[model samples]
Target chain A: MMKVVKRTYMGLIFLFLYAPIAVLIAFSFNSSKSRSQWGGFTFDWYLDMIGDRQIREALTFTIVIALLSTLISTLAGTVSAIGIHYMGRGVRTAVLNVNNLPVLNPDIITGVALMTLFISSGLPLGAVAMLIAHVVFSTPYVILSVLPKLRQMNRYTAEAAMDLGATPAMALRKVILPEISPGIISGALMAFTMSIDDFVISFFTAGTDATNLSILIYSMAKRGVKPSINALSTVMFVTVVILLFIINRKSEKGEELML
Target chain B: MRMLAWPYVAWMGLFVIIPLVLVLLYSFTSGDIHDMTTWRFTLDNFARFNEPIYIKVMADSFLLAVASTLICLVLGYPVAMIIARADLRYRNLLLMFFLVPIWMNFLLRTYAWMSLLSPNGLINRLLLSVGLPKLEIMPGQGAVLLGMVYNFLPFMVLPIYSVLSKIDRHLLEAASDLGANRFLTFWKVIFPLSIPGVISGITMVFMPAVSTFVISALLGGGKTPLIGDLIEQQFMSDRNWHFGSSLSIILMAVILLSMAVMSRIDANQPVEGRRAA
Candidate 1:
């Protein structure tokens, strides 16, 4: 009886979580334009998604921003984490507390803060400002992920390398970097996901010419979302599933190495 | 390594520190948009909350946020416990299921609910087909509360599951050996141990729920306006930067106060990994 109850409860929650997503995917194949009724099954919306110019442009911006932000923030955050790991206790705490603000504060506040900064600094609110905002929010995640790995490392590995003939830079490159590579990779992946998934900050910072998929979706939602959005979301869902599958396999291999 | 850190220090100073300071500056001054010459430092923007309507909005946001957090805790605790105690074969897969929805664009997911809850949407159609009355819950407070629970459920579940799965089984056995029943064991042993996760989850769910404009706008219709909506309106619609910044500061203060409360509850345990809000 207890087992039955647990299974039933799980099923109900699962239904609650996935029903809307299922409706969305079903509507993507829907021949009708109306979201409420399914006329029939068709692939026209998927094809239309490709042909839609605004969507194509938004998709381009989304991908480009996610990639650039991931790359830049990962590099910067990894370096900062290493530096932070070596700092004196007080300075490290203060810096980390500051770093945690963007992560801890509500996204809306962060968005407004960045918006204020750009307007006051005279930076035009376009691709540059949007990218800056993405980097600002994303780098902290990278730092958060990377710092844990840094703490777990064998502190003597880099020191041992330096004790030999290697210079400090060379020791860092040859020893510490490899040890913390997992954290860097995970941080980069998270940064990419955040950059892609972000809406609020992007909504505030993006200018007329520079819009990502989230911003595009928000505008469409207000005016009523189109069937093409269903198609877009389906594609995004599939991509994430495949990406997670690949990452899962790689992490399993990492576990095997540890064992 | 220290040299490598310099760039991040510079980046944080420019992007993180200065931007927040700018919000503070904007919050304290008036005539921000109108007159460049007659800038006056004022607290009227903060004082605006004294109005009954604004107070109601803040109160409503708080009540709804609290309700959602409580609902999440109730629903999430059992699910987390089940997953934690489930067979090893299914554990990661189940955890992935909870997390995957979070990976989807948050706006898209909320939009999905918007359509699903509309008068003639899929859910209503299903109800009608089954000879049941259609729910008129959309575009109201109930719908808003449901949206909050749905979106933030995983936030509650993940943290509790992390803590639950890590708990030493011997403690539960020892409780049983001491003649305590299952319910007693749970209350005395498992529940107390899970407080850190509970605290973290509550803050995680509460912070976002209180500040969310998108969920409220889409699900609650225009009837319910959260602090987030007020802030957005100030910037986007009203073009009142001073008022918006003041509201933002107030929102920050509330969240910080809650964080302080959470830290006081579990002074020793650091919220890390997936629990790192």
Candidate 2:
């Protein structure tokens, strides 16, 4: 009896969670423009979404920003994580706490704070400002991800390499880099995901110069329902599911390598 | 190796520290941020926020956030308990389902609720078809609260579930041996043990819900405004950076104060059940 009740309750919660998503996916294929009424199924909205110039621009911006931010943050974060790992405890804790500021603060505050910085510094709000903001927020996550892997590592291995014939640079490249590569990969993935999905921060910093998919969607959603948005949501949702599944499978085999 | 951290430390100071300092600088001064000579230190911005209308925005933001956090706790605790008690083989899969919605764009998830709750939308259409009166929740506090609960439910669930699943079965067995019934065992043993998770869950949900402008803008239909909206207006529309910075400071203070209080409560909990064997 208890098991039955539990199952039913879980089922209802799942239903509530997925109902909106189901409605979105189903309506993406609806031939009629109306969001409420169901019409005959069609792939026209997807095709329309594909053909839309504004959306195409937004998609391009989103991908470029995500890729760039992930690449830069991953490099900077990994290097800094190594540095912090070797630091004296007192300075390390202070820097780590500072690093947590962006992570801990609300997005709105971060957005406005960065906006004020950019404006005060005389940097115009646009793609560059947005890119900078992304890097600022994303690098801390990379540091967090990489720091743990660094801790788990045998610290003496690199010193052993250095004490032998290996140069310091070579020891870093050949020994330390490979050991923390898993953390780097996962951190890159996280940075990419966050950059792509960010709306509130991007909304503030993107100005009128650049529009990511998220910013575009917000604008469209504000104006009213658009079938193209429904189609876009369906595509993005499927992509996320597939990507997460692949990541999950890889991490399961590797063990504690992904966040 | 520590030398390599300097660049990033410098970068953080420029981007993270300096910006926050500028917010503080702007909040206490009312003039162009660009021109130092134009700056005049004053508390007028915060003083302006002392008005009743603005206070109501803060109060409403708090009330709504609290309400949503409470709802999420009530709904999510049972789900967490069920999942924690499930077979190990099925546990990850169930947790994955709960988290999938969260990976979707936050805006898109909120947008999904917008479509569902709108007048001619799914819920009302279903209600009309069933010969029931239309449920007019959209463009109101109800819709905004629903959006908050929906988007943040996973945060509440994940933490509690982690703590619950890690709880030692031996503790429950010991309780039962002591002549405690299941209900009594849960109240005395399980609930107290889960306080840390519950506290973190509350912080996670409450912080986002209180500070979000998106849900209030979309679902509240501009009829309701939270502290986030007021701050957004100052920065984005009104171009009143002074007032915006003040509001952001208050929001940060509220979050920090609550977090401090939560940690105090967490620290005060009995230490026995907190540790898992």
lDDT of each: 0.89, 0.92
- TM-score of each candidate's B chain against the true B chain: 0.92, 0.97
Query: Which regions in candidate 2 have their CA more than 4 angstroms from the true location?
Result: A250-259
Q: Please write out the lDDT profile of model 1 over residues A26-134, one tens digit for every residue.
A: 9999998888897999999999999999999999999999999999999889989999999889888888998998899899999988888888778988899999999
Off by over 4 Å in 1: A250-259, B34-37, B267-277
Residue B187 in model 1: lDDT: 86
TM-score between predicted and true chain B, model 2: 0.97
Predicted candidate 1 versus true structure: per-residue lDDT over B47-145, tens digit per residue:
999999999989998899999999999999999999999987678778888788887889899999999999998889999999999899889888899
* TM match of model 1 to true structure: 0.95
Candidate 1: residue A162 lDDT (0-100): 86
Clashes of each: 0, 0
Per-residue alpha-carbon lDDT of candidate 2 for residues B187-221, written as tens digits (9 for 90 to 100): 98899988888999999999999999999999999
Fraction of true contacts reproduced, model 1?
Answer: 0.83
